[model samples]
Target: MSDVTIQGNILTPAGWLSGAISFGERIAGIQGAAADPQLNGDDYIIPGFIDLHVHGGAGKDVMEGGDAVHAIARIHARHGTTSMLATTMTAPPEDIDLALTAIGKAVRQRGKNEARVLGAHLEGPYINSGKLGAQPNFARAATLAEVQRLETMAPLRVITVAPEIAGHLGLVRELADEGMRVQIGHTLGSYEDGVAALEHGAAGFTHLFNAMSGLHHREPGMVGAALAHAEYAELIPDLLHVHPGAIKTALRAIPRLYCVTDSTAATGMPDGEYMLGRHTVHKCMGGVRLPDGTLAGSTLTLDQALRNLVGLGLDLADASARVSTHAADYLGLQERGRLVAGAYADLVVLDRDLKLKAVYIEGERCDLNDA
Candidate 1:
């Protein structure tokens, strides 16, 4: 017998269809609409969100250690993220090492109350200081020895780099060769530099249009290259990071653009002080910002990101892909991000209005109503 079964208007790879998914650890079977007579017919069953870029939430910063990993994962899990990369910020070498060590431990010890930690997304040290955004004061050039050591420290699935940094284009090629998903971000690289990184094997863009070079009509910088080249870009659809008009523009230009929560420790918490790397961030006015008023990550979760896209008039399937499938595909995670017989039994159930009601990872439902 299956451990659990849920019936709803499910989104499948073929398209949205009415069905019931029965499962153990992975999906054991799929049943047609008629099979579940008890189904309410108003709930939505879509693949659990997989966030490739997320820093922390619930007053927990990833740099705080492995326990912070569980804290952050549990917070996002309550809102429909079943899997994610535990992201790190630009800090001193010793601090980054500590975060990576903690992330590696969390991957092995994850439980039902938390989202599965796929790996780490190191978002700093190798990035440019010109467009540091919320990152701290310790940026540096990419070094092969440091990256190679970090590679052994944890399962690094992605790294954000500036192609214009001295000797970084070659490092991008090397990391891509090793199957790491290299993304161009936090930089002042021009359009030509972005094209060069893509040519050297970079596969994605991180939190597009934030901290990166803008799309000037004449210069056509990194933003223009990302849009024009159709690179797999992760965007924060929190409605504050990029305006609705710019989001619509990105949607039209990039075919594989997806959503990520570059959330800070203030996310899911009351307005107060919280940490983003080494800096203290203020959370208020429905957003997070630094002392200088720079956008310091966001207070967004993936569930609301889905609602924002649909609110912008995107069809359900397309919005679903942005939060789940596109990021999974970019990381080459074949077994997750789909609600099929062979995929992991990870998903979220939403009410008719698209509000999250429940979340499940590996067939076990998380405590969404916890307060």
Candidate 2:
């Protein structure tokens, strides 16, 4: 790879300062910014965003498999995400297997300008049907045999399950033992049930406050457990799926509350019909919703997510951590989600207005115009 140098006010481990980053593939060096009398400090550089939960973008869903992975990666790259987990919705066993197989293939053969496919986040057939928010018809208790089979098929990084389901606590323990992140979501689990899942090794909550129990002053359901106990939780900050006040509450209560797009095929496209697994969804009025008006997913991109956090009165550094650092730590990826020497050359450049100006993935610049 050829050497590439970027000059601007860069956000590094030491904090935001005038600097230049020079790299080939991995980051080679970060230095004081080049002397330019015309420098306005309007241009800024930050580590590329990493999303833990995303289904699709650019009119393709993960359930479509194969090239759909690349399409999603390329589209999100245009929006400054350098890495993400291909989140799968609840579906038939064979459909799930196919999606996993396709994701595994994409992981092994990622392109230069595409975001890295870290692994798969199985959002489950092993959840409560009562809370099946936009998920297709299949919902069942996870079996040991099925879990074992899934482990062998692909790189499974996260699994969202309902601990209240019969025989799910043991399943959580087994998945956690295998180094997979077990999360609580799509369930009717009470506060005690959520606590028990955590006791058995569940790491966090999926899209907190959505498809899960709410915070009752007396009952303290899933939302309460997440805020009161869990180390990490994913929040959709689109202002549609969750209210801003609730976001503030979670931010104050949880130690590490990161953002996830939970974006669907309708993202980055004109308002129209799109696919969310076997279900058809409509994208209109800047949101994706089911025929019956239930929010199917979001049309949010991480760049906009960062902007949203900043708009919420957070400083740039803190906002950056929510979109990148927190999610990276949750996934156990130490080298990603930060701008530093020896890390992968993944970064985003924004203008004074904070609009995306450029994106670099592993030292290669992605063409935003492609999508």
Candidate 3:
């Protein structure tokens, strides 16, 4: 027997259906009729978001280690993220080890009210020092032994590296061979370098146009390479990172472009200084930044990211895919990012204005009031 049922304009892989879904920890069945041809509706039951890159939330930084990842997961769960990667920053070896140890524990002890901690996205240490963006100054070339050691701390699902760094191109191929989703980022590499990384097994670009080299008509930088060659890439749709026009351009060029929060410790908290790895960042004017005004990360949650995509003239279904489906597919998660029988019962309910009404992770309803 099903443990719960919900009625709404449901988003299914086949399309929208006006129906009631029955479920336990996994969906049992759906029974209902078709919705408007346009798929318009005030009430929506869509697959919960899967964020590939998340730093921290609820006033806790992932670098703090310990039970901090649990707190971060709870905050993102309130914002409709059913699953996420506990992204770590460019930091010392000991700090990274400490953070990943905690992330591994969180993955094993996921709370009923928190989002599933899929694994870690190490966005540090193996990057270009010349183009650190908001990352700390600890960038260095990668070694397979070091990466394998870190993976022992937790499943390193994704690792961001700069192709131009000595030996990293080969490392990208090696990591990809070992089943890690390698990405090119924090790079000053040229267009040729980006393409070489892809040829060598890097699967995507990290945060697309930020921190990496920009496109130029004559030069055709890393962004140009991603636009021309990548099948999947992540972009921050917070409107503060990449301009809407630039986002639209990417949409036309890349087939499986997805969105990520790249959120910081200030997420879900008031304007103030917070730690993003080793640096102190300020959250003000709806964005997080360093004191000198370099865009640090963001305070954006996935639910808000969905709204932002829809506002950019995309239909609700397409917007939903960018925030949920694409990310799930990118990570090879089969039972997530879709609403259907046999999939996990992870979903979000939204009212007319796209405000989050409720969220469920693995069929357990989250207490939004406590967030």
Candidate 4:
């Protein structure tokens, strides 16, 4: 196929440029001049969003297995996500296995107009049951053998573990040594426990300040540990999972903080009930929640995540990094997040209002209307 070229106010790694980017499956060339005030326009071209924690979208839950992951990938691609992890919920081993098997297939057989499935993000089964958050009551302890078996089912790129659990600290070290991105979440672990996990190779915190312990002047729980020591972590920027004030505080503390959707099956669907692993959650009041009114996940898409960050007083470039570049960096993905030459031709086009106008994955334009 011939090269496809797009011209706009391009967001290059250096900064914004008034130029044209040419690409086919990969970026071939970027030609442009410095930003010209006289030619300022409404159009902006930025790298596609990368979501590290994604549960479901478009009426499909990841735990449903089969074609569910495919539907979720296509729906998220419509909202400017070029890639994401197939995040699973806490359930029995058989359920988790089914989800991962489906995710592995999707990763290998990425379909047309679908966001690339990077790998499986095992978010449950091995966690502290006391702080289950929206997770089911199936929390258990981690074992290297079990994790190794799961890895064989799919590429376990990222896993959430509660270091306070028995033998979990050592498991964190082992997984990190093996190159998996271990994250702290769904735990009642103390501040010291959080610190020890970080020292033992826990690379990040999952949905910071939500499922984990909170920060107090005396206790300085997991949230405090993250604020004090974490170099990378993810926050749900839907403006609901975390308050704006708290999000601001985290922004000041963590330099490599990124954004995630934590979206549920109700995403892109009308207000209703949907399955989140073994539990059925309600989608209402702009949030997904359990019957007891606990926040389950979220109804956010990445484009809206970008807008929410900008609304929270972040500049457009900084918001873009949170939604795209930072997550890519966290995953050690060199080719998917930025619009520089030699990267994959994955990107999004937006108007001055930050609304997605078009999306491209591996140089193929998506049909936004189909979303």
TM-score of each: 0.97, 0.96, 0.98, 0.98
lDDT of 2: 0.90
Q: Report the candidate with higher lDDT, 1 versus 2.
A: 2
| Model 1 TM | 0.97
Considering every candidate listed, which one attains the maximal lDDT? 3
Q: List the residue pairs that clash in candidate 1.
A: none
lDDT of 2 by residue, 238-317 (tens): 99988999999999999889999999999999999999999999999899999999999999999999999889888777
Worst 10 residues of 4 by lDDT: 33-42
| Candidate 2 runs further than 4 Å off | 33-40
- In model 4, pairs of residues that clash are none
Per-model clash counts, in order, read 0, 0, 0, 0
Instruction: List where candidate 1 sits over 4 angstroms from the true fold.
Output: 33-41
The whole-model lDDT of each prediction reads: 0.89, 0.90, 0.94, 0.93
- Candidate 1 lDDT by residue in tens digits, 112-229: 5899999999998788998899999799998878888997878999999999998999999999999999999999999999999999999989899998999989999999999999
What is the lDDT, from 0 to 100, of the residue 268 in candidate 4?
94
Native-to-model Cα distance after best TM-score fit, residue 290 in candidate 1, in Å: 0.7
Residue 78 displacement in candidate 2 (angstroms): 0.4
